[model samples]
Target chain A: MPVALEIVSPEKLLLSRPVDMVVVPAEEGDIGVLPGHAPMIVTLRGGFASLYEGGKVTTKLFIAGGFAEITPERCTVLADEAHPAAELSKAEGQRRLAAAEQAWEAVDKMDVAARDAALAALQVARAMVDAAEAP
Target chain B: MPSLKALRIRINSVRSTQKITSAMKMVAASKLRRAQVQAEAARPYAERMERMLSELAASVAGNKAAPRLLVGTGKEDTHLIVAVTADRGLCGAFNSNVGRAVRTLVQKLEREGRKVKIFCLGRKGRDFLRRDFADRIVGDVSFAGKRRIGFADAEEIAVRITSMLNEGGFDVCTLVFNRFQSVMSQVTTEAQLIPAPPPEAAAAPEAGSAMRAMYEFEPDEETILARLLPRNLAIQIYSALLESAAGEQGARMTAMDSATRNAGDMINRLTLNYNRTRQANITKELIEIISGAEAV
Candidate 1:
């Protein structure tokens, strides 16, 4: 049995299909899942989710951090935002990274909540740049 | 009876108004379709997020050290209402429905001796509530001329609310918006945002109980909840914004449809009167001319 993988974003479902194997960018580390993987819930990081079918990588998605719930037969990733790696632009990613840096600096140090938000935005910006260059 | 020229002008004005209302009706109809598609597209993510949260929150509902977002500050004194509406008007009562719902909720909470604050999300809501509850409105964010309302906008609003939660702005927070039911119906809904309400147990409880799997938390429950809760809040607000936009379009379509019909009726009446008056003037002119000829 193949693993049913569903990658959903705030705007829509990006992908849903059964694949031979799937690798997710978990907070702990990159984890690979097959059909019978143990049930686990992990927060995701800003990186790529590579899905393999027939011993080849069929799809690669860049996901901004959210979380995933992995059951025995299914893996559901609720992404903050997602785009096909092929669709990303290096210049756009670079611009976002620069803006994120400025935003991070502009946030008041006394405000922990804003600081956390800026850091998260920076992480996504960095990941987008990296993904764009390599994808 | 009015002169023929005056009657003609009245008919022409009513005809122009009818054209404008009918054009607006068509525009609103097309926009409503687009908004409904957008709202539909965003549903899967929202439902998945809600279900996952419900399952996770069910486990930590009674924990003493639970995140305040999940369990509140353990008080019910202050209430914050995050109400959303359209920025533009002429959507029938779509904006006012949300405004009035917030009004009633504020009054009810105040009568119970609870301190109430408003976090108005759109201009119309602020405009409606400003008459009496201006002081109660702590913040108002309006996207008056934005090309489109996107997830980033919702995230900005969600971030502010979470920051307010951290700063002890209110003990409990409730989100009020008009939920789109159909083109002709929008239900005003109030949902508790902070102190995240537990998922309803009655919904598919049997299926859940039979196949519930014991799962391991990757970074553990508390850490995951801390991250997921805020993200969930943003998703909730995003979906609400999308649905409210759809409802606004739906309301506008219905309103414009009736306005167009009313304009048609007025034009019909004016044209009938104009034709009758023109015929009457012709008859009087012919009588005067024939009488003058006979007298001559």
Candidate 2:
């Protein structure tokens, strides 16, 4: 059974396709969606989501934090930023990673909220680097 | 009498000005198309968010221990204003209208003996607000380098606002922006963002369903509300930004259209003056030559 997936941003719709399954980066952990999953709403962390098609799963995007709403018939991701993996530049990712690391190290001197934010950025940057370098 | 060279130069200058206005009009129209689409697209998400939040708020309203963000912090001594405008100006009265509305709000708030702090979203807003409320401004955000408005930009502002709130920045937060109505009119609106107001009465709970739907909160109501409140604020900011962008375009199109027409009128008037002056000169020369021949 095919599951309808839509990835939307404020400006425009990025992706709307039917796939067999999807791996979403939920706040707690990665949540996998199949055709008949129960209705659920989860906060998304900044990371990558994979969409599976017939006998092939494609790693399509890096989403920068938002939410995912999954119903039996469809799954929708409302992300802050979503770009195709192929569009991710290795140099940009590395630079961002370094910045995140510096920001994280200074997190201790920052307030609780800033520290949390720095950590989230660190996670996203690291995820991007890893995803871009993956074979 | 103006020399032929002077008349030619004047016409050339006016033509150049007309060309610039025409080009600006075209650019504004193209941008208006994209901005309108973005503004329209944001409406559904905002409506859904309001619907969902109202449902949640209605359920939580009965609870005495509701989150502070919903019922507010129970103080009105301090206020924060988030004013959104365009980074660039050319749109007639677009930025100024918003600036005027914000000024009115600020004065009213001040008269009530409340302290005001400003969070400016666009460069134009910052420039205007700083003129009067310079000391009150806590933050100023601008996407001057950005090619398009995106969630990341909104999120950055949201994060800052939420952090300030968590740190006890202000008692109330109000958003002042332009609501895109059509190509001819954009209304400036001021809305309360913090201690989120009860959803508008028109959008409130429907009467047909006297029975309330029981909702099972996944991570507990407080946790969900805590997370959702900040996100809702961000969404509101994002919506306002989109509306202002669209409104700016609409205003520019209207302004430019009038400017182009006005330029045409000026060119016509100048051309008429030039023609009459030249004809008078030719008539004077003819009369002089005829008198000289008759005298000879």
Candidate 3:
């Protein structure tokens, strides 16, 4: 059975397709769901989400922290900031990564919320770069 | 008689003021363009979010186990007003218009014997409400240094509001902001945040006894809704901020343009007065010299 997935961000709809499986970066860890997977709603961390379609991996998306709803038949992802890995510029990603690291080093200066936000941004930046390089 | 040096100094000052006003008008025009773009870009997201929420809320409204955020507490005794305004106040009546609308609502709510607490988003709003609703103010958030508004700021506000909700702080939450309709017209609007206004009527699916569409909830309706509700709030707040930014720029542009024209008019009138005074002075000197020569 094919699973219908709709990937959304506040700015625009990133993707809508029927795919065989989806690998989501849940808050806990990477969660891969095939058809007939258990109904679950998982909080997503900032990372790359891979979609498998028609027996081949079709696309990779970089998602900022958000939430995902996975039913037995469909998956819906609502993200704060989501973009196709191809859309992100390599230089910008690298710049964000560097900024995130600097912010992380000074994490103690920031409040708890700021630290978490910095971490999330760092994760998203790295994930985009990594996904672009991935086979 | 006034010294010529004094008149010269006055004229120079007016010229300087004219220059300043003209420069300000140009700056405001450029800022308005950028602000308009930001506001327009945010509309699609806001509209989409509303559509999604309405669609989901329609289904959830029928379910008994829907989260309290969606269903609301069903009591409106206590009210929380989130006032959105520009931190800076140069724009003519832009912040004050929103402030006035909020004031009217606050008065009306108080008259009805409802308890109203305010969470002010900008410094100008806070300043205005301080004299009247000082005791009712719970929190104040300002983006004084932030050149542009972002989701992170809205998320911070959402987190604070949600925690208050969880703690039973207020029964209803209302957002007051200036809705950007056009460059000339910005209508102030008050929106109810809690329970999300029951989704638009047209968005509700038709009532069909024969057709039953079953929705499978992931984790559970309550759980997903609990998380989604806060995100929706954040997104809405972010959208409001964007709208305010754009509205402020438009208002500033109009205000500055008018000011520049007024200054030009003032300068023209003053220059006419100065030239007339100089011409009269020359005529008086010529007449006195001729009369003295004839008498001699």
Candidate 4:
């Protein structure tokens, strides 16, 4: 039995299909979902979610921070922002990394929330560059 | 009576106006279709998000540690109203309806001794409300140059609102915009935004089979809710913007269509009068020539 995997962005539903396997970047770590996986809802960090078919990764998407709910039969990913590997640009990723680094430095340390946000953005920026450069 | 030349010119002018209005009508119609399609495309994500949220919120409601976005600060003294309108006009009462509704709401809130601050999403709305409640206007944003609005724009606004919430600017927040009902009708809707309203018992499918499934939380519910609430805010703003965009295009289409039809009718009447005047003038000329010849 295949698990129904859905990836949704704020703008639109990016993907919804039955796949053999789905790997999501959960806040704790990467969670690979297969049929009969226990039901769970996890916060997603900024990374790629790879959908596998016939033992091969068919689609890889760069998802920004959001949440994902996994059930035995279905996995739903609600993302703040999602872009396909094809859409991710190394140049833009490099620029975002530099900007995120500067922002991480400039964020007020007194504001813990701001510092955390800056750190999350920096991690996401780094991930974007890695994903774009990955073969 | 106006001369035949004047009547002809009047008919020509009305005809030209008709042409322009009809063209505008067609343009608006196509634009409305595009907006509607965009709204449709965005519906699935919103529905899924709302469904998951309603379920989670049902469990979390009344909890002491609920996030502020889920359970707002227990004060109603200060109100922040977000009025969404179209940047451009000529959309009949689309802009004015929201404006008037906001004005009435502000007056009522003031009478109740609640301080109200308005955040306008369009220029037309800002202009409309600036007349009486100018002091209440806190901020205004307009997408005049952008041909299309994206989720990023809505997120930007959501971030600002979040910061404002953090600053404890207002105890309550309400969003006022025209809800797209159909091409012929747009309902002026006021929805509470700050404290996500509890899902109506009958309206929400909380009693459904899916809600009963025992789903475990990875990082616990509180942390996920904290993250989810902000994204939900952005999604709400996005959908509201999409609805207003579709409504604006619909209003423009309807207004332009009527103007086109009216211009056509005017041209028709003008042409009839011009032809009648031309025929009468010809009859007079022929009668004078015959009478002169007869006298000679």
Off by over 4 Å in 4: B201-213
Assess each model's interface with DockQ, reporting 2 decimals per model.
0.87, 0.26, 0.25, 0.79
List model 3 lDDT by residue over B2-73, tens digit each: 555666677778778878877877887787787777767666556655645654565566787676567667
DockQ of 2: 0.26
**Candidate 2 per-residue C-alpha lDDT over B1-296 given as tens digits, one digit per residue, 9 for 90 to 100:** 78867887898798888888888999999999998888787765565556556656765776778766677677888899999999998899999998999899889989999999998999999998898889999989887877778866787788888778767888899999999999899999989888788776435456613423533344455655666676677789999999999899889989988988888988898898888888988999999999999999
Worst 10 residues of 3 chain B by lDDT: B208-217
- Residues B149-221, candidate 4: write the lDDT tens digits: 8998998999899889889998899999999999989999999998888866426455464653577787888
Model 1 Cα shift for residue B184 (angstroms): 1.3
- Residue A104 alpha-carbon offset, candidate 3, angstroms: 16
**Residue pairs clashing, model 2:** none
- Shift of residue A46 alpha carbon in model 2, Å: 4.1
lDDT score for residue B128 of model 3: 91
Write down the worst ten-residue block by lDDT for model 2 chain B.
B208-217
**Candidate 1 lDDT over residue span B1-296, tens digit each:** 77778878887887787788778878888878888888888899888887787767766656899898888998998999999999988889999899889989999999999999999988999999999898999999998888667888888898899889888999999999999998899999999998787777526667675444477788888888888888788888888888898899889888888888887888788788888887887898999999999999
Candidate 3 residue-wise lDDT, A1-135, digit = tens: 888887877655678888999998887788898988775666777788899988777898888767776777888887878878777766777887898888788777446545666777778778766655654
lDDT by residue for model 1 over A106-126, one digit each (tens)? 999887656876888799889
Q: Go through the candidates in order and give the C-alpha RMSD of each one to the true structure.
A: 1.9, 3.6, 5.8, 2.0
Chain A TM-score, structure 1: 0.93
Model 1 chain B: weakest 10-residue lDDT segment is B202-211
lDDT of 2: 0.80
The Cα error of candidate 3 at residue B15, in Å, is 2.7
